[model samples]
Target: MSRARPFPAAATLGILALSACTGPQSALDPAGEDAAEIAGLFWQMLAGAAVIWCLVLGGSVLASWRGRSLWQVATALKVILWAGAVFPTVVLAGLLIHGLRLMPGLRATESDLRIEVVGERFWWRVIYHRDGAPPVTSANEIRLPAGATVEFILSSPDVIHSFWIPPLGGKTDLIPGRTTRQVLRPTKPGVYRGACAEFCGASHALMALTAEVMTPDDFARWLQAEAGPAAVTAGPGPDAFLRHGCAACHTVRGTEANALVGPDLTHLGSRHTVGAGILANSPAAIARFVAHADTLKPEIRMPSYAMLPETELRLLADWLASLR
Candidate 1:
């Protein structure tokens, strides 16, 4: 009896899966110095594994099919001893030493920019520590100057979360009451997705952030703008945002909406996403999130304002969108 094969389907699926290894969040498609070294290590290890696999499997097939005619018992034993044990040991030891050699460069701490990223529930609170100025606070999104080494001081206030931007570097856990530092030198100016790699709560999977790498001049302009107050100071949206008790949690630097319970809304309109990357940054999305945040992100700390009138929601969303 003969058996049928599914090689065509398997081959198609394998190609599709491999195609996913080259995107914004792919470690294999690294865009930074640390990530490039990590990717190199991965490829080297993969090559070593492939060589070992081919040799071991080929030897097994040859032994089962034609070994008796080709080798004496003593020679076969010698082959098994060296091939099964000694070869793997040497290869793995070499790989380990190569991996260890990369640690010092990856762990270098003398950075040009310092940013503190705090994991709170399902959102990221990003604070920029400038050289000669007070720390600027933002949320959900991080911007870095391309070609500069940036150090991130990571921590969590409640539970453990892992800060990982695959295109840049490795994952660093954010443990409560303690800090973990990771340095990344971004070489590309593009938007990369970041996420919490640890499972923390009901909405852990939705905890995502955007990291945009910019040129030095552009980053300076952005930082200057972000350090300032809200661009839209007075309007119907600002009025509704404050009048409906939104000020109790959020902060809009130029206005009276100064509270730290929620994400800093000082430049909320400028970000790419709402509710920490759960929704696109638009007037309608903002209105929907403001009215139903709990539904959009499960078990979140933000209270829902489902009762807000549609017109008011639109106004507030417009005001926030104009804040840039």
Candidate 2:
């Protein structure tokens, strides 16, 4: 008895699976829009090659089934070889040229705003360039105008580090005594997550940041507030902020803390992350760092003053928070 032929479901499923494999659109795939276009072009080339392969292989099989002479096999081989060699070369060359043209836009420029970003031991510093010589300072969070051009000039205070903002652009390494730059112009206004792409030291994994893209007016107001002095201080926190010798490593503009060994905390309250984005910019987080800097960040140069009472911690946090 003759056996029944198999159903064509296998071939149909294979085709569908092949189609699904061609579109690359996930976070794990980091090529951005350019990669998708390139993948599409590659799929087209592959489909053309697949068609030739099926035609040649199927013709050879059909010829054998029909009891044609072996010479028909040689003809199919010649057609397959010539078509495979000529078509892919021409098509790939065209794709390469087309891709090269798109490359310039991949590195395109925009007249968006410029923001200078600095990397530190456990935090980040940002300086918005204005018409005059603006004071350099550090904020736990970065705010930018939506649809603005942001050119980050990255440099490290001590060791080498990397800056990465996932939604807007790729990683750029910041080296000591050198400046590296990346430009970004996000169309949407929202928060973007960032981290230190390069391993700096003990606390490398914990260092993270947020990129807050805001409306133009809000950004301007933030700049103005940062340019001004810390809000009026009136409690024990002010005394502690001074007596505790925090100024030796941090500088608050218009204050005596002119130290440059650490970040310029002139606008600390306005920032959202602390210790180089290791922790949130909240009263509890700030108090924890002040009380036990080593527990939160091991081997950190900043010494802990955990002996301070919770009331004092709250006072310090309130004072720092009032700086906005």
Candidate 3:
């Protein structure tokens, strides 16, 4: 028997890289009810297009090869009528109606939780609302309970930005001065990547966030912890933060840093990433961001503290990390 030829290593690598399509950020891998519906619609349309393509193109090739017989001409005309016009009309109309029917059900009748998300220039301002409780404000990351319907009321303080969590729900535009709502029922407990799908401005590519879907009990615990004020400690970090006039733009709960120009840092230590998910939430990463934020994220309004002493920067990173 002849030996089969081995696949090239580069081709194998390419195939392996395609696995990224099904990763946590992929629309092909639906982890929530809304994404599943959208994926289903996409697959159905793709299959229909493939069938139409085969019928139209294959029929044309066959007609050209077969002589100009009356039978061939009649058959080609019939195929053109059905595949080119009738089939497409019927298929598109059906898909349109199916999509319309799916829309109303996608909006959950009863939401287990409500979150107000405001799109800033390059970050997300998240407010978790509770019944008879003060809103818990955070930034760049959203935590939700798996297997629960959560409603997001989205708006923009500046320009338009689209909120899209591929594995969770569809894209919803955050229009300034207008509130848009989207409902998501995440079925899996994992971190889903989200970003601004619309082109806002400079650093729009860096405008990303993480959606942490946890079990109901764990979500409750996290919510409680986030609802409280920032953890106070006897450290130089808080002093350094204040001394540098960081309070003029950012806010850390239970302190005098109540400026609304930037993101809330009350639970910054607990977040998975910093600088709008541009960096991992580590001491070194935090220190680098605090010292040279503009270098990492250009055009950001937060000024760089590259002149600060290394010791003070380290203390500031440690203090922020200790908030958890």
For residue 97, what is the lDDT in candidate 3?
92
What is the alpha-carbon lDDT of model 2 when measured against the actual structure? 0.70
Candidate 3 yields a Cα-based lDDT of 0.89
TM per model? 0.93, 0.69, 0.93
Native-to-model Cα distance after best TM-score fit, residue 267 in candidate 2, in Å: 3.0
Candidate 3 residue runs with Cα over 4 Å from true position = 1-18, 70-76
Two-way TM-score contest, 1 vs 3, winner: 1
Clashing pairs in 3: none
Q: Which stretches of candidate 2 lie over 4 Å from their true place?
A: 1-110, 233-235
* RMSD to the hidden true structure, all candidates: 2.7, 7.6, 2.6
Screening candidate 2 with a backbone cut-off below 3 angstroms (N, C-alpha, C), the clashing residue pairs are 112-149, 113-149, 122-275, 122-276, 123-276
Residue 46, candidate 1: C-alpha displacement in angstroms = 1.5
Question: Whose TM-score is higher: candidate 2's or candidate 3's?
Answer: 3
What ranking of all candidate models by lDDT puts the best one first? 1, 3, 2
The TM-score obtained by model 2 is 0.69
- Candidate 3 local lDDT, 10-61, one digit each (tens): 6888898878769868998988999999989888888988987887788778
Worst 10 residues of 3 by lDDT: 67-76
Q: How does candidate 1 score on lDDT?
A: 0.91
